[model samples]
Target: MSTYIRQIKKNVWKWKNENGIFSVKKYPTVEQAEKIRLIHKELEYMEKPFILPIIESTQEDFIIQPWYKGDHTVSYRFKEDRKAVHLLLSQIHDTNKLVDWEDSNLFYSFNLISKWQNRKWKMNEISFFIESHIGWEQTKFLLLCGDIALRNMKPFNMEKRTLLHGDVVHHNFLSDSSDYKIIDFDLAVIGPREMENILWMHRVLPEINYDIRLLIHEFPHLEKVVRRYKEAMMYPNELYREWLYAYSLPKERKQKFIEQLIPYTNKALTEWPNLCYTLSKL
Candidate 1:
């Protein structure tokens, strides 16, 4: 039987053939393509097998790589896989190799918070979807978190900022047998170590449906810092990025993934503040 790759989403695919499992994704620019190449190199240097090897595509359409055959990105078995996830992250985070990119990520995260007042989309129905579920107060707190993170989250001089995976959600974690590997680098950026950890623990972890208390207990030393960072993450910049990406697509191609987006927003708002309150007392 002839094996074929199936589309997982626009410009993304998963399939297995006679050779092995693989995935392909479109790169918006050559710079992105180069960045992925650089990331793969760094991962190899780290002696980590978590990153999937890139398969060069002869055409200019998409970047191809071996698909992790073990499992897809999911939230279950977090406890069992958490250690491997952290280990892989530690290796990647420890690298000093710099990819060519500016440090506008934090700015971008909170930029909308300040400008939302003047944003034409403030009254747009999409905004209503977010506000209705999260409430104005929760919204205000999130923006506040953005403000604080923008102003206060700084790089540690001891451990210089380095390249980060950018998107470290639970699903990026692939478990092959007993080991775990990470996939996706299109959103990679260079930032402070603390910021990377903060972003993962605050934003990505929650999105993956992790229990905030368990996270706090797992890393008690980082509790205060994590909470502070979580507060600053009231507005996840990634959501805006995703919406912009989707909006740029043809109407027929846009699947209104916002259906999932709003609930995630609500989940963050509903849980974060309560977690903050709990953390404060502890």
Candidate 2:
């Protein structure tokens, strides 16, 4: 009956104070953020001294977390933790072990995620969800953030590895001078790291204004392996470059590039003999 509730129902809810926020995207197509917020609330119901942020309450139409109040952007940032990232990976792997797959994980899959809940379209699947209804390849491999790429690894872990944030990306990790806040676990499937989130950066970093030399110079440890993957395969220059994405190339060229990358895929199976058993099945 409240204005906030009405706006939220229409998928047009905004923060009570949307002063400096530039990009404001609501649930977008329909009422989904509300349902997501609700599920998080239920998961935290009857708990003492909530570990996560205030996710939901009958008092507010939607959940709102503290956001940054600034206009400055970093020109040169340095991350100083390698062990923390590996530790986060271990935590994610452990937590991810507990969850099964759901339909919402696929960005391209349709029918599997279609749902009409309480008279509105809602998405509740994890990033690993498959479009298929059943099976091992369809379900087991559908886990979000399972793909192996190093750029998705965050150099910091502030939530202390206790609370399950489910999704981890640079955007979700916030800091003021020396502290970091993990935000938006609403879409989380109770466990997993940044498979999709990391892929987003890995997929887009090249297209953005990122400095590749700087990226390699500072984040040398990870890029070493990525560059090696791109270089190891004895394929055409164009496709081999596209395969190990320490950066994102144009999608318009993806198909042609994939054609170029196939030989390397074959070569990868050849050179990485230990992985030959697994690659053969693919």
Candidate 3:
């Protein structure tokens, strides 16, 4: 039932089982694994019944997978990023406008849902996901892959139970000459838009460098694709702060992240003309 991939990459080990695609992740320790799982359970409660790749106690490590559709990855560029972004956003925006999340999620009561526990909030037991006190599960947990850097947008909606490319990132799409297919579903979940995904209209694509910076500058309207996803993000201010603190590592790591993020922000602000500072205080 299990097909193994030798020489697995960093944290995840991928394989094929009688069931489907699977992965194994080696956490630093059992405590780390438990912490992450607890956080994820809360995330599931917040969103739809998020069915992630399950965790298994293997002889050697923890195993999981995002439940892949079919195996595939490609290195070629799509014929057009602008066209893809526009087409995808237009379709999604029209769709989202029809659905109201507060009304939709009202059907699910809070008591039946899982809540964060196990950790004490007492003075002795406090730990943080960030220096500012975000919790790992609570921090920037997008209902969907809000990070447009990577994509395999086989669209699917959690509440509607319709699957399409959920993400519309440039690279998520691949065209073998004429046909196109999505490749990643790591962020898929089943719920309404707010809890299932932070679909936004002004999302930051993970493009770096002066060339992309220039492209974003010259074609400012193209940023609308990024904005389209930003529009649907549903994080409340408190949860947003909590999630950041939860996942924020030590000072060195935070420094590294800030280094990587500021430039992206600067570039985005340039083309966007009215970009909001999500992490300004941090």
Candidate 4:
């Protein structure tokens, strides 16, 4: 049997052999691995276009599964990919009845407002440094958005709570000819499903040039919920989150990321008001 090994990312490795390709990720603890294993089991029977992972084994702090062979949905600019992601996410949320994750410490209740407040505080803590790099104008704009977003924020309907994928970035959805799969449950939690949808919009809106109308038209199911939370969406959550994350990287890497972010920051600033207006009318 021939085998080849490659490191996919930190703490994750991929191996290909005569049988097939497989992924091995080092979980922080055996308990965490077990939790994820249970989640996979619950989602094992989801419908097509929502291919679930097939766990091969879990031993010690290592959980292994077949390495899904496909490019991430982020690589495609088609509406079909987006639709597939939403469909899969909807299915996952619908399956909430199958698991009682609330009792698990790993899947705690989410507090949107408190989390936003904490993130805002962190941004303020590094404001001076960020301003130096991105200019006072951009820094002030982002902080202002954060403030408004917080003010506009409302508590989620806890009664509608379901399993949230937590991180709905496009890269988490993979597609090949045969299947479209959602991966990476490390950030998964039990929360309002709408929160997950909001995160998804934040990630995809920029890609579509922040066209609120176009976004709603593509996913009409979101129109009502999105309109209800328009005020929160008006805040540039993605920009602030990216900036804060870039701040933690090594100096050179951080500088490079900041440089690339400048154009996006400027564009978002220019479009912010219009997007808010469009959402308001919706």
Candidate 5:
């Protein structure tokens, strides 16, 4: 173990001489870390590379295998390696990694509400944001995607619950000549396979030129579910607010960002009805 630490950012440190990378996480319990480690070993044995190759960690701190010099942006280039990306995600979702893992995807469900409440405990201000921006009326309709899927679509029709990387934001994916890999598993857990794909569809699709039907063909059972989730995505405002609110900023600056997002969110909402209908016919 390297005692020398080079600070890369807040709470994130790099081992000297490119040994590895480490970060201090705020949640996912010590037990979850252990499970992640177990999954890494399993992936290695199965000839799949779990990018989050955990080197070692305690309750709050964990290390990852060092990444090579390459493009780490999570973007449309993923389309270039679509088969590899789908293989990686499918292998992950299909495997039974651990038992009693928490659900990480926020699909429409009572389970998601429970997880939201738990998350709210940590980010108390999010509750205020939710109340002021996404009130009960919105929350009720938020999971319509989940409801439609569970009611109409069959379950995963697999042996084990799908494990999710949770946060599929593009930056979490790294690319090189060989393939793409995922990082940042602090929010990793078991959940619906569609939920993860849905995130990729919204977060990665619009930025790229690839046809989303490629993803649909890969997970045909999840076609409608994926469409529903995609339709529900409230752009810039809802998405940006969620992403930006986490940063430690001055109160005034944060409020400014929120206010600026209102028009964009309203525009998205205004277009959603027509968009929703279009997606429904798909």
Candidate 6:
């Protein structure tokens, strides 16, 4: 019998048996499965120095891939994992070819500006509630940063599109033995490479205490992008995103998140001006 391991999300689960471990994802339409198969095929063709799950089988509503044995990157050494992830991302972008998405709309083009604008509007709508919880000064600072980020960001260029992994959180990276592999393509889309890089930065900067210089030093390739889109780096996207998410949770959970968030929010408020100045000089 298969032993239940853990729930990956609402409808996905991990299971183990004599054959070894595997992931069973439920509720994917046939079209969705086809898209994932296509994406996996493309990645396989590239033969990059990373591992993606090999789909063992698929049913009408479920898909299975043999479990990769490893911890998420968060449990590994950050510096090494970061370097590997960045290199893998570069390879993925380098090998990108236009996908024939056709009628499925499984992988749509990313519209950076439009998405940011919508986020800005959502933040505004909930500003009063957020301000009531976090005080006016903190809320104002986040909103200001959002405005500046939007101002500095360029419109999406359709010509420079590539297949983006979409979600770059450390949890999505599996530290398999000596190599890192990316997983969970639920949010995958066609977008500018910079969009993925920006999200990766948002996820990692907090770990480094928001030091832009060190970040660029670690990844020299990012220097040009950082200099070009200074305000986007300066924006407190993670803080704002967390606050917005906290607003959606139940009262107890929201309160717990707010308690944890206060220090992070304050830290961002304190460092944002200095970050802006640093970016300006870059």
RMSD of 2: 14.4
- Clash number by candidate, in order: 6, 6, 43, 0, 1, 0
Cα lDDT of model 1 overall? 0.60
Q: How accurate is candidate 4 locally (lDDT)?
A: 0.80
Q: lDDT value for candidate 6? A: 0.76
lDDT score at residue 170, model 4, on the 0-100 scale? 78
Per-residue CA lDDT of candidate 5, range 1-282, in tens?
A: 555666666646666444444443333355555555655665666665747455555443254555444554445554555545655777777665543334433222223333433433433434445447656554334333334423343334333345677776666667776667766665676666765665556654444322455556755765777555543332222343352463356776867766655554455444545544555667
Superposed Cα deviation of residue 154, candidate 2 (Å): 24
lDDT of each: 0.60, 0.33, 0.37, 0.80, 0.52, 0.76
| Colliding pairs, model 2 | 102-129, 105-127, 128-142, 128-143, 128-144, 145-195
Stretches of candidate 4 above 4 Å error?
Answer: 71-76, 103-106
Greater TM-score among 3 and 5 belongs to 5
The TM-score values for the models, in the order shown, are 0.67, 0.33, 0.34, 0.93, 0.61, 0.90
Task: Summarize candidate 3's per-residue lDDT along 1-282 as a digit string, tens digits.
Answer: 556665466776676666666656766665445534543443344222323535555533354645444233333132254444444334433333443323433223221012111111221133332323323442223212223212322222334432222444445544444433433333332233332223322232323221333334644654443244332221122222333443456766766665554454344334331222321111
Among all candidates shown, the one with the greatest lDDT? 4
lDDT of 6 by residue, 195-220 (tens): 78877887878887778898899999
- Cα RMSD to the true fold for all candidates: 5.8, 14.4, 13.2, 1.9, 6.9, 2.5
Q: In candidate 3, which residue ranges exceed 4 Å CA deviation? A: 1-4, 7-11, 14-79, 82-171, 174-178, 190-200, 204-247, 250-253, 270-282
Q: Which should have the higher lDDT, number 4 or number 5?
A: 4
With candidate 4 superimposed using the best TM-score fit, by how many Å does residue 90's alpha carbon deviate from the native? 0.7
Per-residue error at 245 for model 1, in Å? Answer: 9.6
Model 5 deviation from the true structure expressed as Cα RMSD, one decimal place: 6.9
- Tens digit of lDDT per residue, candidate 1, span 1-282? 579879999878887789877788887776567767767865765554677777877755478887666754555346556656766777776665543334323212222224433232433334444455457776565555444444654334433566677776777877766677788877776656665666566544563454666776766766766555544443345544444454456767665665666676666656765655654565
TM-score-best of 2 and 6:
6
For candidate 3, what is the lDDT?
Answer: 0.37
